[model samples]
Target: MRIPESFFVIYQPKYTVPCVFDLNERGTFPNHPSVTGTWGFRVLADTDLKASVQFAHLVHRPGKDPQTGKAYEWMVEETSIDLDDQLTLDSAAVEKKITDSEIRSALMDAFNEWHDNFVPMKKKKVDIEELKQKLGNVVDECKERIRKELVRKNQHWVSSNIPRRIHDFKYGLYNHVKERLYQEYQSNGGEDSEPNLLKKIALFNRVLDNFDHEDLMKPDGTVWRNEDEIWQCWIGFAGSEDEAYRICRTMDAVFKDLELDEVG
Candidate 1:
């Protein structure tokens, strides 16, 4: 039988993040004229706790490099995976036989994944109400405490703090994406040879500065003129397989941070 979809959490995220500080050296982002970019994530499996990611690459567009006849550098490819019964069972002997470095790396990631994604044949049901009671909170106090953590569902972005709330969210999300990518890169046999992190950022910033187009300016009609007044954004179009893999990982991290499972 197909592994129950319930065993895997589902999410769809379309993010437009702009940070106050720049990760690239030339300082600001979204600076280029045709400044197109790409990024994506992959599925990492651990025994029974298998991971399958489905995400859109918000990076580059499809076209050929006019001179080289090569495809535009789309960061990652679209991908999916369905695990077999033996794989889901976390068979030790089978894992030993699987010597492909990428699969092994993914398995390591899955085994050490966050508690929410790990599944065997059952689940642990933590008792929240009992803990609330033990913490000296009566029903009314508990109600009030819960209310404080709730987000404004019907909030008007133009008239409320929703934009600011989203701003903070993307801030954390960006860091989550970058850090997860770096870790995955190092894990999957990426060697630090002639790597220049600052130079990459500087080149990215140049692309942003010269990006005189309307694509990156979408998500909201807000223009990125005043740096001090509003946060700066990091936008991408075409992404790669590793990028896709890490994208899912980063997104899961963001969602888990909300502790939404326990709250809403």
Candidate 2:
């Protein structure tokens, strides 16, 4: 009868500990002199548990060497629980996987929705009226205050230092209008008041005028004027914060005139 071979079980407290052995007959047992390489088993540990009973075994194999026909291998034994048990995964690890998968699925769905539904819808609808309304809204909110102020101050004929001065002017005018709105809001019992309505109406009128002016300036539009020095000056003066404030003040005065006209 053949006697059963006694297997030596090596116990490593840390799973990161590498198992080194030479498959070649010429290499030593513990330290392989013929082949110099390292192999380790990865251990996924439950961060909450300090004991050895909370580690999951994962096998790691490095790239094979062409010269030595020997391949490295190591066994990872389940320390916390049986490998067959799905409950071996801690709550944290399961939660992380679930969260990661959810994020990935959401991103994919968003991409597909944009590609399939949104892009196609964009090409189908070509509403010029809606587009005009949107453009009008932007121009009214952004360009109206600057235009009114420039016109009121009679600064339309001055030269502009930079071509982008109109952009700066628009920003300045927006801030001025916003501050006035805030002040009106505060004075009229906060957001719920007649003064807020008046403020909105005034702002709307200003925006409308701006839209009209822009349309007039366009070549194909009704009120086309040659690019003049006054227009340049208006843009330049409006670009400066101090000049922009002056222009807004002039616009406020013009609104006061309108209020008087309505009363008259």
Candidate 3:
């Protein structure tokens, strides 16, 4: 009942801040002040739990407006959150509670069901004709519409007079071509063109994959590169009555590895 590590969504949280410096009153820079506030952690356990909290701070800055040479005031806002507390949560408790063998088994079962339901095969035929009919003329057309909509919705990233809508349309067109090729190969005798078809499918799939947000933060109090590492740690400590003590040891190791002070 072991699950492929990728089946689970591992959470990781990261903090970012500017470096600070102390300067001599004589206009000469003197020493480097400690730079703090950046760290990352992965949530190995409790997929359902919300682990991090965000806090914000505000500031005022002075500036001048170009139109009116007179001095004008401006406001600059600064924000920060304290992650150190949650980042030190006991890892053993997380592993024991979240990534236990039973949870892994359940995840595998769910993943298998999802994979079987989605992947194309001979015996389990996907209703291409129905999909086409429901989605106007071409199956590619439907995918294109979805892709364009996604890009349009994220128009903040686009610039230039070309119109953000045009960019999305072009992206959608390219994807449509790739999907059409895939559908054609699948409908015709798949053996000769199957590999090429799969390549095209992968290409279009990659485009669709780009719609996810890149800045998502993981839950607080966990630190592992990936889900597999988290699961391995969990499996090592499962089924023990002294779960808290075991968790403390695991946390100690994690902190040492990250060069962080041990949390009590």
Candidate 4:
């Protein structure tokens, strides 16, 4: 008896119609592309099979008959296999054979063998190098902003009377950027590589630059402090200090550099 269609899973290539595989009494299966593409099917369950099997590939020639005006399928490839010669299958043996590296690799090889025969070739090529350069530029810009707008501001914390206030501003900015990077990493297949880190840094920097007092106020006239509000004092503060402190940080090296620049 033929294996039930439900017992097989077709590993059809993306953007291609499924190739039909139908078994007959003689163990011969003739396959043709729906339009013209390739696919491989795998048997998920063990079943009784014929002693011999033959596979044939058919192609639908593009041009139509001048008189009949109908396309025709032409047999282009053929192969065969004898199951009895290959093995006597027990559950363990079948599982081992299917999982074997050679067999697994062959499955992918067969799937990729099919290609578009009818379509004309005129696909636009992507400039991968150009895209890479642009991405590098954006990351570099983010790094520059981090140094100038964020790290450089550490000078204020060095001399300020209220040290903890400035410390939270620095700490808050660190957490904010870190949180942004973590979120981006989770969405990006968990790769915390330098490039991805830089991208997220650039993104959070923009978020900080756009912070506003009007967006953070509550109905009771108190400033709402959550992820959005990076610093304290939503009402009395009338300058960019709060926003800068919450969004950026100062380091010892940056503070030293600021003093030197001032002396010069």
Top candidate (TM-score): 1
| TM of each candidate vs. truth | 0.22, 0.16, 0.18, 0.18
Candidate 2: residue 164 lDDT (0-100): 39
Model 2 bad stretches (over 4 Å): 1-210, 213-235
For candidate 1, the lDDT comes to 0.33
Cα displacement (angstroms), candidate 1, residue 57, comes to 11
Model 2 Cα RMSD, 1 decimal: 28.2
Model 3: CA > 4 A from native: 1-59, 64-72, 85-264
- Model 1, residue 100: distance off in Å is 6.2
Each model's lDDT comes to 0.33, 0.34, 0.32, 0.35
Model 2 lDDT per residue over 1-264, tens place: 010111111122232323332133222222222323232111121212111112222234333435565554432222232111111224344343334455335433433343233122234654445534543443343344544554454423222222234444346544445545445444433433434334333332332333445443422233423333234324333443344344455456545655676699
Which 10 residues in a row give candidate 3 its minimum summed lDDT?
20-29
Question: What are the runs in model 4 whose C-alpha is more than 4 Å off?
Answer: 1-16, 22-33, 39-54, 60-79, 85-264
TM-score, predicted candidate 1 vs. hidden true structure:
0.22
Residue 178 of model 3: what lDDT?
A: 45
Residue 191 lDDT (model 3): 39
lDDT per residue (tens digit) for residues 1-264 in model 3 = 121232221222232443211111121112222335211122221222222211111112345545555443322222212222222333344344343455435433443354344333454564544432332333333333433554443223222222434445347543434444434444433333434333323323322222343432222322333433333332222212133233334333433544442242
Q: Per-residue CA lDDT of candidate 1, range 93-192, in tens?
A: 3245444456546544543362234323223553434432322223233323322322121112222433444455446544544544445445554343
The prediction achieving the highest lDDT against the true structure is 4
